[model samples]
Target: MLSLLLVALLAGSGAIGVAAANDAEREDKPGGAATSQGPRNRSAFSNPSGNLSFARQLDFKLGDGVFRKLWVAAPSSTRSSDGLGPLFNARACQACHLKDGRGRPPGPEEQPSSLLFALARPDGSPDPVYGKQLQTFAIQGFAAEASVQISHKPRVITLADGLRVTLQQPQYELRELAYGPIDPTTTLSPRIAPPMIGVGLLELIPEADILARADPDDKDGDGIRGRAHMVASPTNNGRQMLGRFGWKANTASIADQSATAFLNDMGLSTPLFRDGFGDCTAAQSACRAAPDGADDDGMEVPQKLFDLTVFYARNLAVPAREGIGAPAVRRGQKLFSDIGCAACHVPRQVTGASEELPELANQVIWPYTDLLLHDMGDELADPGTPGDSRDGRLWRTPPLWGLGLTRRVNDHDFLLHDGRADGVLQAILWHGGEAAKARDRVIALRKVDRDALLAFLESL
Candidate 1:
């Protein structure tokens, strides 16, 4: 009768599809069994995998202490945690990545802390005054590079159903410059800190698998050409390695990324970047002459401490999907693939044998990113010059595994590189180049269908 017809329509529309995805995941993939799942809690995104051994768990605790520990200015009593800044952004990693969650652009009357600015010239050289990053904080007696100011302009997009969503385009202003006026042609990129979950799992994704998914030349003619970023690896004597971290995919591994953050964000040198005077170019004479935190090991962040912090970063677990059993989410999951979003946001990935952490190996995890660079076109591109030497139009595919918990964990709902789009839908509307067709499909969706897709995303 009427009930039977309803069931048939529901089945046709993928009402029961999510069970299949979940059922397949029942293979008991150790790390794949999503680590954090429950009602919202402060520690939701800050748990170690329950599968770790007692000794390994202690190691995670050690790394957590280092990760959250605040660095003091050099010549302090605490020699191990000294060497904060001649010029820097935040004192601790937790300051930027609050609660191991995403960072947003500053709100009204708030100074930028979790966010940092990148300064580069048109010829791919660092600015003479600002160097590479603009640091807004400094130790005693030293002037910070600049003060950051942000304001938003609203760009409203009306959907097919007459629903209007206002997206905020961020305007960055640099004031109280310590050195001099910036070059007229200098390009500025403001980066909001991304979530820290599942970084180790993403790192463990086999290089071969990443390469297999790359279609740099668009040989398949799908208009989705994802290319791996090649960057000089500091760990490998500057040999070329696939860039897997950062907005531009410019960082090779978790170790390199952590070291870069320590040096650039906190002005604390690590074993990789051994200079005690962080990102200070020769022009900044005061910064060059500043005291360092180097102890008996001759490095600010000693090798063992550096490795412990990297381990902490590598093992943070991805939160489990919340509403996978919901019919609306199932439909949206199916629709996500049908609309070609999966071409770039490749959902399922298996980790290879991990030489560093074996607990992260062979898990059928869903990170929802190819970790490849895609051309997002000019709208999202940084004005003037490329952020790195890479194309101005390109950005690395950010993972979507912990996205649903973003607002819950971070208390704000900003998305994208600079936290421009207010939420996920605006982020989708901002997509272009390789993802244009997918964006078009989302724009053209019925209100119910769009709701379903958003439901699916929220379930993630």
Candidate 2:
């Protein structure tokens, strides 16, 4: 995931242009200083496995025997499929996430339907018009389930001196629903495709590594405590698990997450997800007209496709940093530690046995997150929605590895639950809940210090 973001951000300027950092100006900043931390500890974010460039071996990994060999074959797109949906967003997984990857946020100059997220739920029901994902396309001969519209709501931010600035939010609109309106209390959170890199390793990180860092009560009075958020498996298997994917932190594993993407995002399916009934409402007969599952061209092929996808995402490497080379970046790293940003965005971790792949076993990865959940307080809470074992506002501390690459990958720097910020700087400004202390410290820093800290994040 971090590596994907880094590529996107680094290559972003091509479509637009990266605002070059003024090295001299950065060096002059007081807080963005250099320190002799002596070749800082190796960042675990980098892929500890070997090279991970794109390759046919990565693209294909067919297995043995017709049954177990499902582990090596690709799930072919069939005319009438097993895991597809009567209601779905795209025809292929590569559509929204281009290359089984990241996407550009919808915005000015971008195709109206090129980007999709911000789904709408009517007054009381959980279903969405274009089936739950606010879809833009439809199967041949079928009318699109619904369309999406956007509006803006502005709120005032008051300064210490009473100066106020308006913050405008791009509101989501659901054009049509097959059933009733969403409950007045219903809330929404927009999500998009995140990188598929390193997820396997992330899942492999021992649960103890996660719990050892939990301090939900803020025992030290640092006011920054973290917890874990476990959501229902949705495989509907009655198993609740630590959420490892999605902005809402809802998915449990690459397999489940991948199956969801296949069913919800694209109208595809695998043996795992037999049908596309996810967003289908009981009232939508057409959407549910198919059998329990979709096509079967590759129903048996999921094992292989999923494993490689797992291998790719799990072992994709993090770019090696030459050690916060600049003085300002170094100071920013220290400030990051001193201020407790590291508390939740913990710096490092080692991967466990892959049992599946020998190559990824016992690897050390620096992902910058403990993969736990935390309450971000009211300022960031999505009211009306209660969370898991934690509160509604809690979110997994996202890994910071390739955060700097947001602009490149998605073409915009929207961050948080609904793309609330445009850059790391703005995202930091929006932090609350357990990390409020760290957020306050960031605001209190002088221009130089703030820049240094940001430099540190950028350097990540």
Candidate 3:
């Protein structure tokens, strides 16, 4: 909040000279508090904070190596990068989060890559056979958990102005079960990779600041109820903390998220997760017995490499806003608030001091997210429970800072958890439950107003 006030003060003092304008412009950088825009092109998503120290920049590059390094099966000379999959979805972190942007669901003629199937039984336990995530790939001499086939059922929704939008409803079928037939009642959820920009700033946002936005019981009775997701902290010995990352806000810290990704996405073990046989349950004997590439440090990914990767993920800058001063974008910004979108997508937050990464401390940012979970109703709900305080119908409000650059960075505009929504409007049309009123407001808007609203989102 103080950061915003400083920007306002500088704007008010026109006599302060050119330096004031430059500082105001810097404040407008979208990575917010830590905005770093580089070259303004397809590679815009990849950069450390512009304000980062020279020493820290070297660390960022080191982490980038680990993020993009390809892993292999054990018993290879490349022990540092070995221990890929007994069962896994990808061989590297960059596979899903390409260029640190979002991952899309497989197209009709393409095989699935970045998308993963999270499997669970009726009582929220991992499937007895496939474990937690279905792995379609395995190392040499190992059997993958299963093969997944996806088909889409087309559906249409008409807005108030007679605009008909077609939406895809994905249907998944598990085939070629490596461990025999799965339980008939097993549930599945699709988790598409989210863009990795300004997450470090999100991590630094004070818990008190986030909690202050929560209206768990809708005490004001505005028909909007948002609550923080409490999850077991893997780094803190399972102590409950506000969940900040993941589709359901199922993880508390960036460390947990990075560690989990290494193990779950790549089947590579880290100090936090010592298992080289990632996601392979006891029943999957062949997978568990697969050779492990534990280095002298005793984990597939040593502590230093693991920490470096997390550092890389934590500092990916948010792309700068484009055309913020345009008339349509200005109008859209107002309508965004008028339609109640800002209630959940709060525009401004200030980070508390951070001893670990001082660059992230004490800055104003506009990430346009509350980082809280809200029930999105039936249409958006997944088939399975996500975690504690999370069910089929709830999801964390994703930040909108770098949203406009999604097309440039990932080369596709697919959005939402499953990459089902073709663009921003469709994503809004799909909103329900707490966002039902916002959806109705957008539907009733005049075409001009709707266009302006979209323009405002694009400016982000």
Candidate 4:
């Protein structure tokens, strides 16, 4: 808890900045911690004042060897299984996730909805928002490559004084058709890759608290009840555990998260994800002829590769909080707690014991999330593959550190689970399902009050 609180203050270059403002695309929500707007963007601040050096000591900082391994732009291959992906996104983990820690939208100007989560139905049809992440280049005779970039549509909406805020929706488009049409029915959806700091801390939280935060039965009668989403914890072997990572809380651990990313992002296979090959539906022919991860004999490549990649993701540092000493940001911090954002986005959490990283053991931390799933409302729904109950309208509340530098890190600034907004503000605007009331309350605030809210978010 102490480490987390200190991280909130601006210490030095090691620390990150506090806040910034948003444009019209964020009209639905407010701006940063400091602004010409309302309430001085002040909010109450709560942080743990533990020894910073001690916390860092416990951190599993990735070594140069592992970090270097990840930056290769090519995956490692074993004797039997060659680094695969006749059908994949990029050659290495850092391709789309650049710098190993940030996600940005792709448009002339960064907008929400930029980071993309790619997937196809069992038969290879494009999901609505995500046209087709279909792989273009396979092995030698494989397909060309799936198109992955964003396109935009311009729009004009005039305000009361005839001040027109022209904006672009920031849409993703696939180019250079490779093989056949996507199955008319494949469900497609894109989500930004979240930063890796504090994730290990999140993974260590006792599931009891996570599940305890849920009210799946809505017994609270707040119409905003949230519940836990259960998924397989890669660390738990075949055992299923409380889902924690990913937009939909679909993945269970850093390793599972890495495995999914390697296979889907690069078409590489690991022991956990033995097959990099995808099932080709009738509509997509290239997929039919694709190369798969072959374990012909032993499994050395996948084993070592997954281990290092997992280390890289698991050890990344949570950006240090810089410039948090500003008076306005502090005020905005108070307002943040006054509002219920802290309810679902629960502020302080302590990690369970850990053998791998002693620094991770029993130390309290501030992750600002309940690690539960909430229904969010129709305004934000992508209907992205709708079988899971809590998740169809829900998303795990992503951590808020390092946001000020998302652009610097990932080179873009699209927020939200599915990249629905141009900035953090739009992500707030899209909060409608169980959060409709909270959103409406935020929208009703006067101009200054709204700016204050936005400030608080930027401070995150």
After best superposition, candidate 2 residue 285: deviation in angstroms? 0.7
Which residue segments of model 2 deviate by more than 4 Å?
A: 1-84, 98-104, 108-125, 128-133, 153-167, 178-180, 183-185, 231-240, 276-278, 290-301, 383-390
Candidate scoring better on TM-score of 2 and 3: 3
Candidate 3 TM-score, true structure as reference: 0.93
TM-score of each: 0.92, 0.73, 0.93, 0.73
lDDT tens per residue, model 2, 98-124: 432344446642322325553333332
Best to worst by lDDT, what's the order? 3, 1, 2, 4
**Best candidate, lDDT-wise?**
3
Q: Assess each prediction's global lDDT (C-alpha) against the native.
A: 0.81, 0.54, 0.83, 0.53
Give the per-residue lDDT digits (tens) of candidate 1, residues 332-420: 88899889888888776778886567778877677778899899987788653333444778888998877777888888878998888
RMSD of each: 5.0, 10.2, 4.1, 9.4
- lDDT per residue, candidate 4, 1-460, as tens digits? 7654554342211121231121112211111111112121111111111222434423323322433332211233443335555555555554455565555554464322225445555443444432335443455555654556666566554433344444455455655656545445554566666665566667778788677778988887877577787776656685877888877787788888777666665555567755545323335445544545445532323565556556545544454454454566655555565555666766556567777745455644556678777887755555454324323567777777556556555556667765546676556656777777666566555656656766756655
lDDT of 3 by residue, 1-460 (tens): 8766776654332112232234435436755547784766788888898788899999999999999999998989887888998788898888999899999998766555689878887788888887888888888787777777888898898877899889887788887888888878788889899999898999998988788778889999998788888889988998998899999898999999998988888888898999988899888888888898888877999999999998998899887776776788777877887798988887766778989988888877778888999989898989996456537888899998878888988999999999988999989988999999999999899899999999989877
Q: Clashes in candidate 4: how many?
A: 48
The residue pairs that clash in candidate 1, if any, are none
User: After superposition, which runs of candidate 1 have C-alpha atoms over 4 Å from their true positions?
Assistant: 1-34, 37-40, 384-389
- The candidate that wins on TM-score is 3
